[model samples]
Every structure is written in C-alpha cells, then in structure tokens.
Target: MAKRDIPEINAGSMADIAFLLLIFFLVTTTMDKDQAYIRNIPKKVEIKTEIIEVEQRNVLAIKANNQNQLMVRGEIIADPDKISEKIIEFYNTNRNVNDLTNDFPTYTHPTKNEIEANLKAAEKELESFEEQDAGDALIDYAYSKIDEWDKMKRSLKLFGGNDFPLINSQANIRIEVQTRTQYSLFAKIQTEIEEAIFELRDTEAKRIFGESYGVIKTRYISDEEPIDKGKLDLLDVLYPARIIEVTPKN
Candidate 1:
C-alpha cells in the first residue's frame, strides 16, 4: 500500500482578507443615533420663598397614567396626535384679546414707554444696590431684574408695534406622569409640546423676520449673529415654553 501525502492549506492571506472586510463594513455601515429631549433642570433653592398660586386658566396640565391614558386640561385625549392641537389652542386662544370668560391665559400688552420706564427703574435699583454694597443675593436679584427689563426692551423693539404682547407671567405647561407610565407616551407628550411651541414661533418668525424659526435657529447656532439672536429672543418672548415636569409618584 502507498501512503498518501496530505497537502497543507495556506491561511497567510486570511487575516488580510478579514481585515479588509472589517474595514469595508466599518466604512459602509450606518448607525442609528439615539433620540433625546433636552431640558433644563431647575436650580435648587436655598431659601424658602413664598409660593405664589397659579390660576387655573394659566396652567395647561397634561397627565399620563399607568395605563398610558392621556388627559389634557381635564379632557381625556384618545389620540396622542391631538395633543399638539390642544397646546396650540391654549396659546392662541387669548393671544390677541383677553376674554375673562374664557379659560385660557391672558396676554399683557406693554407699551414702549412702560418698558423703558421699568428698565430705568431696574437700572437705578441695581445701581443703588451696588453703591450700598448689598449682599450678593440682593445684588444678584437687582441685576436679574435689570436683565429682565432689558430683555423686555429688546423684545419690544423687535416686536415693532405699539405694544409687545406677553403671556401671563404665571402661565405654564405642567406634565404629570404616573410611575408606571410608558416612556413612549412621555416622549410623545414632550414631542407634542415641542411641536406646538415650534409652530407658533415659526409662524410669528415668518411674519416678523420673513424667515422660518428653524432657519434662524440654525444660523444663529452656526454663526452666532446678533441680529439672528435678537430675532430668536423675540420669538421666544412671544411664545415662551414654560414647562414643568412633575416627578412620578409611586
């Protein structure tokens, strides 16, 4: 019997081929980005300030329960898509004229003269605080008041009208969710709120600046232009998203 010789298989290029395939996949494959909602966490208060009561008309309450059911302003919403419409209505209902009979937030139209007078007063208070060497807390409070008045002045200038309309200071959108509520529903609520606010601001931006809110925001982010920043500030002042998220209770 003749013994057969076994041939050796060559694997010298196997590593190189695998490396090439890895590189190809790495270069050609696309990854999905994680979506997230960015929100500012309120600063912790060291002092116990007096709690001011918010009127029912000024609060837009959105609630979600363990069953994922949604309720807005005491009305149950079957379709999540309608949430945005409700939000839009809440803002637009009393935007131009106030009707005390209606259960919606009221608008305040502050004239330029009024804004200027308040700004001057704020400046004087700030100066007095500085001269008196007031504590940091009081001085900071004065500075904040001055900043608020200055912001109002800029907002009024950009508004380009006899008066700048502002929503009630106490107006806010509050979101309350149960501990077992689905994250998807919570995210949907946030999305609806964001969509409603964006639509309002975009409409106003187009009317005032002849540009879209998204475009102005993108440009401001990229270039940091003062004009675009002012436009954004005015738009924000017109449709501020004062949102409060309540902690889910067990």
Candidate 2:
C-alpha cells in the first residue's frame, strides 16, 4: 500500500491579505494623548539654599500612611470623595493680613511695577542699615526690613496682581506621603485636589468670562483666539492653587 501525497494550496494571496490587514489597523486605530498635570517650575540658575520657615496656620498638611489612610492636619478623613471639599475649604480660608502681630505680608492688589520699586527701596535701606554703626536696635530694624523685602518679592511672584480674593492670595497646601503608600491612593487624592481647584476656577470663569474654565482654556489655545485678559488675570488671582509637596517619609 502507498501513501497518497497531500495537495499543496496556493500561498501568494495570503501575504497580500495580511498586508491589507496591517494597513487597516494602522489607519483606523486612534492614539490618545498622554494625560498629565501641568506645573510651573522656576528657571533660575542659583538654587535657594536657605531653609525658610512657613507658618503652621498657613499650611494645610495632608498625610497618607502606609495603609493608604488619609489624615488632614491630624484629623482622619473617612471619605475620599470629601477630600476635595476639604481642600477647597482650606484653600479658600481668609487670613488676617492687617494684624500688626501677623508676620506674613498681605496682598493688596498692587501692580508688579510697584512691588519692584518697593523691593529696590528695601535693598537700599538694608544697605544703609548695614553701613551704620552696629547696635541691637539697628540689627532688629535691618532684620525686619529683610523680612519685608522678602515678603514683597514673594508676593510679586505669587499674586502677580490684586484681582484675587484675600483667601486665594494667602493660602498654601502641603502634602506628605509615607514611603509604603499606594500610588493609586496618592493619584486619587491628587486628582481630587485638582478637581477642587478646577471647580473653584470654573465657577469664577463662568461668573467673569461667561464660560467655564475648560472652554476658556480651549479657546485661548485655539489659533487666532482673542482671550479676555482682565478675566484671565482675575482667574489667576482668584485661583493660585499654591501646592507644596513634601518628601516621602516612613
């Protein structure tokens, strides 16, 4: 008995079919842009070496433990959804800038040029004090002037203008995460914070620009789009979103 030979099928069209399938996938599939949080970074060459202290009242400290449990300024927060509300409240709190006992400088909506002028005058005064004979009173005066100049400089950068509410101009946030904390929890918390900020900004945008922040930002980026500058400045002053992230610890 002899084994029958198998028939060989034609293979020329198979390669062409695969090529067409590859082309179809390449042309039809859509790619999504990578999502990210936009942040402002300083461009100065000399890094700040001083360990400046921040007031306890101005800092909204949020901590995430290894178990992903959250504590806001020593109080446990049960619901993750409520984090945004807490953040909004913390960011919107008003400080008493007019009190003589208070240390931090107040933002009174002065122009950038005015701030620059003040900084220059302060530098001159500090130099004059240094040139004078040394005394305890003179030293205290010089130190006070230094604080004033530093506060003015910081305000020039942070507030930029006076259109913002006093609450927005003065508040700051500090987040501290433990080393073993889950990335998902941290990401969610960060998202909530950003949502809270957006909610506030969007509300202001709607009130002043007659559009939501999302729409305003989109239109502002479009070609030949003319944005309302005053409204934009108002938004900046109203929602500064000052966040300070601390190093992860045990």
lDDT of 2 at 244: 70
lDDT of 1 by residue, 192-222 (tens): 9999999999999999888899999999999
lDDT on C-alpha atoms for all candidate structures: 0.92, 0.67
Task: Assess the local accuracy of residue 206 in candidate 2 as a C-alpha lDDT between 0 and 100.
Answer: 81
lDDT string for model 2 (1-250, tens) is 8999998999999999999999999999878878977666533345356876765656677788899899887789988788888777665443324443543333345556665786787777767777875665666667776665555555445444442334423457677898998988888778888999899889867875578887766666674353344445456555667877777854
What TM-score does candidate 2 reach?
Answer: 0.61
What 10-residue stretch in candidate 1 is worst by lDDT?
36-45
Best by TM-score: 1
